[model samples]
Structures are given as C-alpha cells and as structure tokens.
Target: MVIAVRTKNTQTVSDYNCNGRHVFTQTRELERPLVGSILQSMWGVSPTHLTWSALHNSTLVDYSWSVGQTPFGPFSEMSTLSFAQKDAARRNVLLTSLNYSISSAIDVLDSVAAHGGERKLLKHNQYVEFVQRWSLFKYKLDKAVSALSHFDFELALYYLRSLDHDLYGAHAIVYHASQELEASLACFKDPPFPWATVSVYAVCVVAFIYVYMKRDKLFRNKRKQF
Candidate 1:
C-alpha cells in the first residue's frame, strides 16, 4: 500500500569569460509495490498489470528551467498549484466516503450471515438467490478495489454505492423467511388428554385393594383338606 516516488536531477554547464553558468532540472518516477506479480503468482492472472506497469514506467512529474541568473523561484505562484490542491482535497473526501461505505457493507453482510435459522427456514430457490446476490456483491467489491488500485476514486465510489439494493434484498429475504418459519412452527399444539384411559386405570387399582383386604377370610377352610 505504499507508493515510492524517486527524483533524478540532470545538470548542464557552460563557461564564458572565466564564469560558469549551471542549470539543474529534475524528473520524477513513481514506484509501486509488485502487487501484480504477487497476484499473478496466487491467482494465475495479473489484474493490475497494465495499470501498474504504466504508472511505474511513466514519468509522473517533469520540470524545466528557464534561462535566468537565478535557477530557483517562488513556488507559491505556480500555475498548477491550485489544481493540485483541489485534486488532493477531492481524493481525500472520496477516500473517506469509500471507507465508510465499505465498512457499512461488511457489517450488513455479517448480520445476514449470522441470522439464526437462515438455512432451515429459507427455501431452495430463496437460498440460491441469496448466494447469487452475495457473489455479485463480492464481485463488485473486488472491482472497486481494482479501481482504487489505479486511483480511480469516482469509479470505485460508483461500485460501492450500487451495492445497497442487493444488500437490502438479501436481508429482507432472510428476515421474512425466518418469520414465516416461526409462524408455521407455532401452529402445532399438544393433543388432548386421554380421560377414558385414566378412568380404567383407576378402577383396576380399586379392585386390587379390595382383594388384598379380604384375602384372610377367603382362605379360612383351606387347612381342613390336610
């Protein structure tokens, strides 16, 4: 994530009447990390090849010196100074906004994934649609990152802004499906009690108690046969 800028100076000299005149000029080169190479190694394709190569191989800043007694002059009066300042301000604002949007999107995604009973409650087609939407969301995020790598802030913002509808749709699908599932589960109630079976059991218990109490009188003549 670090950008390195290098400056090289070239000087010209001339001699006239025992006095020497010297002119110094500078050129700037930008060096970014070998991200494309790393990506190529990992994924077998270099997404940033053209952009990184163009940025690294081109001279970002070039300056020329006019013929004068003094080589250095006031920098505040430069014609492009105001434009550079404005560009920097705009870039800063865009970066801030992008950061907030990305974080919010991630939060939304996490909330959807963490919802309870999403798998059991959602139908096959609904789950499939959710998966497709998630894939699309991630693809857009990747494209936004690619745009950012090339410093295309506006394009990156556009991609980030477009994710809202998909995100909300996914959330609504899970929420409504879970609600329906809960409602269906709530419809089941316990069956009524078996009062007839309980009454038969009570009669059997009373008959057993009566026989136990009369057992001695019923066996009074049993010893006469011996």
Candidate 2:
C-alpha cells in the first residue's frame, strides 16, 4: 500500500496513498530502522524496546556512537545524550532514547511489581502513573510503528520522540526503585530492636495506669455533685 510519486516541489512530502497506507518521501537514514521497526512489530517485539536494546548494548561496547544524517545535517550523528535533550525544539532525535528506556522498563515492570520492587520504593502511586503513561506510550508506539511500516519516517520519528516527557518521568520512578531497594537491603541488616528498652516502656505504662485509676476513684468519691 506504499507508493513513491514525484511531486512538483521535489521536497518529497509523504502522505496517504490510494489504499490508505502511508507513502515514502525520501530514503533517509531512518529507512532501515523504519523497516526494522515494522518487522519487529510483526515479530511481536517492541520497536522502542528494540531501540533501547540496540543503543544500550551498543553503548556498553562503545561509549561514543552516532546515527546517520538527521534533519540537523548529514554530518550530525544522533546519540543517547543528544536524543534525550529537552531543548530539541525543531527536528528531534533520529530515535528517542528516553522513550526506548521507558519501553524497556515497562517490559520488566511485571517483575518489579511481583517482587515488591515498586512497593519497596514506596511509590505505589507510580503504578497508576506507569499504567496511564504506558497506555499513552503504547498508543504513540503503535502509531510510530504504523507510520514506519508505510515508510512515513517523519511521522514515525515524530511519534517516537513525542514520548520524551513521559519517558523522563518513568526514569525517575526507576531511579527511586533502585534507591529504595538498596536502602531496604542496607537497613534490613541492622541489629534487632532493643528488647530491654521496650520492657522499660512497658513497665512505665503499667505504673501510669495504676496511679491514674487510684487518683480517679479518690477524686470521684470526694466530688460527688457538691
């Protein structure tokens, strides 16, 4: 359902074809990833997660990496830092690294929920946050995948980059989860409660109750409606 027709402007604008599928404008650097994203969708892999895995794993191998020519320039290369920047007002990154991070985190969210990972962080509200944000993320991801499938790279990139705010928020949740886990483990290893101090508190409570009852009765007998 994809078509490639020449327009008078020669700027290569993409839009819907006769069969209702998107058409490709130009074969930019995003073409391969777009096709790969479509294939990943068919194969039941998340496009965002796949992007994360590629970037994350690649970074472990090489700290410095860059993608091909973006709207910025052919010489300009996209990186995780560049993609995750908040000031990208014009043309956003080739791929949204933060968006991918959230997608990757959502995949493991079940594990975190099952093992009290989120609970340890005391971020029960994040469950709701994740659910709502993830729903939106999925919607955008679906649109991106669809756009990519029909070779609408610009729209696909737009949708992918649009998830930055939600993804950045997700990063905070993940950070808290890790911090909570560490704090709990560290604190749990401390010495047991001071039983001797607790016994002292118990005796004080018993003595206070005895004195109060005796004083109340003495006062009641003397103050009888006088």
Which portions of model 2 miss their true places by more than 4 Å? 1-103, 106-122, 181-226
Query: How many pairs of residues in model 2 come into backbone collision?
Result: 0
- Give candidate 2's error at residue 133 in angstroms: 2.0
Each model's lDDT comes to 0.54, 0.53
Question: In model 1, where is the ten-residue run with the lowest total lDDT?
Answer: 66-75
Best model number under TM-score: 1
Per-residue CA lDDT of candidate 2, range 1-226, in tens? Answer: 2233343553343543424755444444454444434333433322222234464564232212222322222222331223322223222333444356556766557556655665554466876786677677778777877876665667877777776556656656665665556433444577999999999999999999998979978788889966
**How do the residues 1-226 of candidate 1 rate in per-residue lDDT, one tens digit apiece?**
4344454543223222222434222223121123323323432332211223364884333222211211122111122223333444456665665677567667756655565544765789988988877777778878877987787878977887776566667777776775665433456778889899999999999988988888776566565555
User: How many backbone overlaps does candidate 1 show?
Assistant: 0
Q: Residue 102's C-alpha lDDT in candidate 1?
A: 65
lDDT winner among the candidates? 1
Alpha-carbon deviation at 112 in model 1, angstroms: 3.5
RMSD (CA, angstroms), candidate 2: 20.8
